[model samples]
Target chain A: MAINTEKNSYTVIFAVVMVVVVGLLLSGISQVLKPNIDANKRAEKQKNILYAMGVNENQGANDVVFVSDDILQEKFDTYITEQFYLQGGEKVDDPEAYLIDIKKEKKKAEDPSYDQKLPLFKGTKDGKDLYVMPVRGKGLWDAIWGFVAVDETMTIQGVFFDHKGETPGLGAEIKQRYFMDDFEGESFLDDGQFEGIAVAKGNNDPKNEDKSDNEVDALAGATITGDGLATMLRKDVQKYVPFFKSLQN
Target chain B: MGLLSRKDANLILDPLADNNPITIQVLGICSALAITAKLVPSVVMAVSVIFVLGVGNVIISLMRNIIPSKIRIIVQLIVVATLVIIVDQVLKAFSYELSKELSVFIGLIITNCIIMGRFEAFALGNGPWKSFLDGIGNALGYGLILVVVGFFRELFGSGTLFGIEIFGNPVEKSGLYAYGYENNGFMVLPPMALIVVGIIIWVQRSRNKDLIEEN
Candidate 1:
């Protein structure tokens, strides 16, 4: 018996049932997979942090290979000596500092009275002490974020940039080796002034030899993404200067 | 041929050439143009579309009879979106790195008209088995064009295929580069994709005169 399918009542009932069914199915799948997805995200964060501090499995000039999963936790534990964050200008030790959400902190800090927790990882690579900081900012299409590892002098040791929805060939190249490698040896301070690096065009130093100038050659077609990255570095890294200065005293 | 009858086989074969979703029908040109810059991404997107369309066709076909005509489009959209999301969540759980690489493209699958086009045009009037075959055929047709376009773009634009240097290193001035050959930077841009697709359509129509419309 074919029920009258053209009835408005049938259409409304079908729509409601479909919505409820789809909602339940999607929510159930998400709930079941939540733990595994969360674990994967945690592992990725650790990998990114480790990658920024120059501890990675990269072999080729263009490779950005992270350490394998089997030894990732071991490597992370061995390399990262201290995990802490600054809240109200006070240092607080946190074992899971890397997992802190920078986006949420940024939103909360907009209240002005809220003291945002700025997570920092201290590690030693090649017997030289390094500090790794996470930064979040805008890109052409969506959010872009990265981890930057710097030494006591605030010179960039290594960086690992990633984006949520940047264009594949253009803005997406920020994560590529050629662009990220240029950040190395670039100092955040110029003669003790906290002057951030700029992704400049026609800086006349395409080879990036003038690290002291606080400028890296910009990507060919990715002007806005490059500027966003430079701004992100300047704004986010500026907050940590006070703590780094206290280290000297 | 051995498994399927002549009529059934045509359902799987017709879209591959004379009635292709991309070339002949011009249904899903948007994604074909957007993600065909590199061979790997093109292949990945093709495989993803194949999965979504094939499964989506079957689901829509199974529900064709009871689906209200007034809200059938919404129901079809829900099916495609649900499938894409499930695939995305599963990939994120098992293969986080690949999920990251396919971040935007996976979401873009729902927007590909081929899935909805197949559902509305064919699956709504067909059985599950035949609809499945049609879905696979159209997706294969789309994939073929994508791979072809990706091949030319990546080779000329980056001097690489699947990220392997086929024309040698452009930066180090090796192999073809040593002979003063330079990568065409324009080929990597989106406009070049349209030109490449246009060239494919021209070549296809020239070979098959029947496809030419009488104006």
Candidate 2:
């Protein structure tokens, strides 16, 4: 029997109907899964922070243990306190709208206030108040973002890095716990001045007479990525300087 | 609608062996080259692809009759995008960290040629059952290459497989896998994936010379 797979009215109508049905079905399923996805993201962020703090004992980056979503949420509620924009040395009055997503605003260059609404995460570790501030900037070929936890005096407690397009083994080493460990106990402020962090290159002996806590060696082979990171950190860290200073009083 | 059956399982299995997309057809090599660096992610990607391709094929075939020729491509796209979004959302909900690791690649599946090609070429004229089988067969074809590439990249790149240390590291006080050959860090680089893919294609062509011929 010769089947007429022609583009007749019935065929076109059927196709449109089928497409709509499938679209609706998939959307419904996606709606059902949305909550799970959000939970996962929160848990992963916690896992990364723990790894950066050297709390995870696994040798490979893969072995960082993740607690269940319920447990993670419970811990997060009790521990992590999400802070929004702190302008003029005071936390924003209405932080709801100020919880800006920098990712969504990158394309538009019109708003100067866009840069001020900083999203900060604060929690406790080892009986000390650890304030984790978010930072974002360019890497050699892509964007790099991370969380830096600083103690009461603005000294670095831990750092967690995630990048979009940095070269592996070179710039991508930022994701390694050892690289982040280098930041522990380092100072974001030196001599009462906010000097921020530095990305130097090579065997930068922190013991070398000239090296200071504000500077750490960059990955050897990724010069562009390293330079990009240094520039990005310089710019992003400055945005939170006021917020950090306000906490002192 | 009834023309496609397991009786013609060759229609499905043949692609995996000879008309392999990643190796022979080279239809969807982008993901293979990028995500193969890690075993867990590569495996997740492979499963995601299989899911999308299989579903897209069956849906497109079922709706082939009603879709307007002038707007068929757009209709196919809607179907593909919907499936990709569902998979992405499902991953996010159930395995958030793994989903993050998979990242934009899951969304990128919407553009993967294997799904589009199967829908347009094979599924548009077939029955839902036949299209589903064809989808699995073609996905297997693409997935075989992904697994091979992912295995090599993860094994050598990270000095481990699925995060487990296969070769001991004397430097890290683990063991001895030849003092300095602990981990071939180069395997993790994207360029290494390209080279590995190139080798797979080379081997595939050598075994089946007919694949080299332009159809």
Candidate 3:
């Protein structure tokens, strides 16, 4: 059978072949860049954690330090020694898996393969042993996630907050250092007790002067976001109070 | 089909001016509005679209014959998707940071109607080279309007180009525009792009009476 060029244009076949060629080309490129992209993501997550804990300046998104993979592991190891997970008040079988990809588990709950667990990262800064817990929930406009590091006694060491689709310059201030810096040295426990932090209005001047230290000032124009952050922190941090107490014992 | 080529060019070019995509067609209004807030990204988006539209047209046109008439749309889609992915991957590799900023918009190029429109109307019937030229032409036509609208938006919106402060900020560290010195809160919003595109349409119609008649 002779294929006639008279009726069938070689252009058509050429284009289809080109599509397959280009597809394979892009796949190859994606594979080559895969490690760099993955490394960038991991570095970014670590930088956010460090920034939240007041160890690094919150310069801006995309401004995080891009250290080599080896250095990153070393730096992360210096701070985060161990991690754990809990169910009700008992320890889960494999808490280590939670650290593999917290973002994955946080995004979906239907995956029974992932046991619902809170992964804790143990870190020591200035001779203080701090436990970092990841919390995620809905904000005013989109998803909000953060890392809160608490001392063995459960004093809040620092906090970092990130959101998607929040109003920029207003609710988005959660990403700003000024806002996160306030979380530093702010006690989660007030009056030798763990009532956690309260997000309040008007400088957070509580009626009870004693509770003021446990209050974080509300973002001027972002009431819903502030309240949402407070609500998320209250519920999530409360879950680990028993586990944190166990560490003390 | 010989006589059709002449008629087709007229039909396509007519919509570009009289039935303008951004203003009249409003087909790709989303990116038009969002990216216009910043000059560089808007320009980048425009160029990227032009590349995709032009190349997609050429590819689809070349494949017009053996495209199996029943599943033509699928063939066009495969070609378009392939081009979009290539562009998306290229953007990520070279401009990793900017790619993150653009986020889903790059991937959404697959859904862009201008690209699909070119494939359906022109590429499917034309030769490879003509389809390529027509793709570039339509993309150029689309991009022309975007840059013009984006110029005004970025100038007044943020007083910056590619995030560089073009208009020397004032004593209060405010830009040339007193109202929108810090940032044009309005320009960042998607609706502002619509308003800019709307004004461009109004201007085009007022100048070209032919456009008004079509409207």
Candidate 4:
């Protein structure tokens, strides 16, 4: 009340000082918490990869429980035997391949000259070899991404979908166990030809009993997100067909 | 009651009903509709709003004297943004899963009109303690309406509460579904939320004749 707060000079000075103080505070906090956040992200990635390969602690039908955080490293190490990437038809082993930013790689691969390094995790679950590949795409509201685990025949063993900002109870239901479970036993190849699975509406297979048809029953009120998922599978999963075919030879 | 006087108690209690933020003031209806489709997200949004508003009000009230009236709006905005970011970063670091669930809603908290409305109308003039109480009161009021709306929306819209099936499995045709009852998909949409809020307002006004306005 005593100070002349109405002055333009006073207003400008206050604004500048406030901005500086807030900026410093925010930056300091972010710097200190970066490690923890990064660690959480890494653990989440491991969990998703493992989940896709069906190495989880799910006890109930609807549960999507991942390996616990305490033993996450151990589980990841034991199950994920190798982390590698496919670049220009060559397999390159990379310990940090799982950490590759799919969004950045997708953007860079837009140019014809860039050979995008598609990261894939080779894991052994229940005495069967599984390859988990990460896929990213646009959803109804924002970005949607997931891990798809397939066998040598490119048949889907399992999948784990996640979204950044999809509508809850609608598009967001893509991550639910029921939705993700439908992808199991679905093959990306139809008679030795690449045929990406579709999240089709009116497929009339609500029970998802017909996996060989290359279509899964779509979530109601989530047409755009379902289409996005199908497109994402076609665009990203199609890239690994050569690698799987080489394995067969 | 021992800690606060009747006047101070009113600051924290009045907004819960007579001056409810969503139903009465009509502030922050956007979020009330957006996240209230489910009970879990609605509760989370409410708790986040309570924390941000409480801390924000106190900060604004403390800086009330020095804040230039010309740029006070900008200052308030900065405070809300800063608090929201801090909350978001901390949640990401400590509770990553929860932070993911609340991804967009936390940022949406910055745009909540109730935060700014309180900062301008109450915090700029009131003392810090009073402002904090006011913030808590308004947020609770908003949250009450949100929870009520969310309860109906999730139950009718999805046949569930907090993801727990109340009417058994619709797919299996059990419980209410056996009687040929179907989940009202319209109840999940945003427009339905508006209608639900309108119904609440109508019920409240009818019960208390004092709430009705003569135009």
Which prediction has the highest DockQ against the true structure? Answer: 1
Assign candidate 2 its CAPRI class: acceptable
Q: Mind giving the per-residue lDDT tens digits that candidate 1 earns over B48-131?
A: 888999999999999999999999999999999999999899889998887887787789899999999999999999999999
Tens-place lDDT per residue, model 2, B33-129, is 7788888888888888888888889888876766667777888888888888888777778776787677778988888988888898999999988
Per-residue error for A14 in candidate 4, Å, reads 1.3
Which pairs of residues collide in candidate 1? none
The residue ranges of model 3 lying beyond 4 angstroms of the native Cα positions read A1-33, A55-99, A103-117, A122-131, A139-142, A150-157, A164-185, A196-228, A246-249, B1-20, B23-25, B89-96, B147-155, B166-183, B207-209
lDDT of 2: 0.73
Candidate 4's error at A90, in angstroms? 2.8
Q: What's model 1's lDDT at B209?
A: 100
Identify the superior model by TM-score, candidate 3 or candidate 4: 4
Interface RMSD list for the candidates: 1.6, 4.1, 6.4, 1.9
Q: Write model 4 residue lDDT over A75-153, tens digit each, in one string.
A: 9999999999999999999998999999999889989899999999999988999999999999998999999999999
What is the per-residue lDDT of model 4 for residues B1-215, given as tens digits with 9 covering 90 to 100? 89999999999899998999888889999899888888998898888899999999999999999999998999999999999998899989998987887787789999999999999999999999999999999999999999999999999999999989999888778999999999999999899999999999999999989989899
Query: How close is every model to the real structure, measured as TM-score?
Result: 0.94, 0.81, 0.71, 0.90
TM-score of candidate 3 on Cα atoms, chains taken together? 0.71
Candidate 1 chain A weakest ten by summed lDDT: A54-63
DockQ, structure candidate 3: 0.14
Q: Relative to the unseen true structure, what is the Cα RMSD of model 3? A: 6.7
List runs of model 2 lying over 4 Å from the truth: A1-27, A48-85, A91-122, A140-143, A165-170, A202-213, A220-228, A239-249, B1-6, B170-173, B178-180, B202-215
Candidate 1: regions farther than 4 A off: B171-174
Estimate, for each residue in A71-188, the C-alpha lDDT of model 3 and write its tens digit: 6666766766665666546665452432456556555545656545666677788887877888776779988888898788777777778886687658978877667766766776
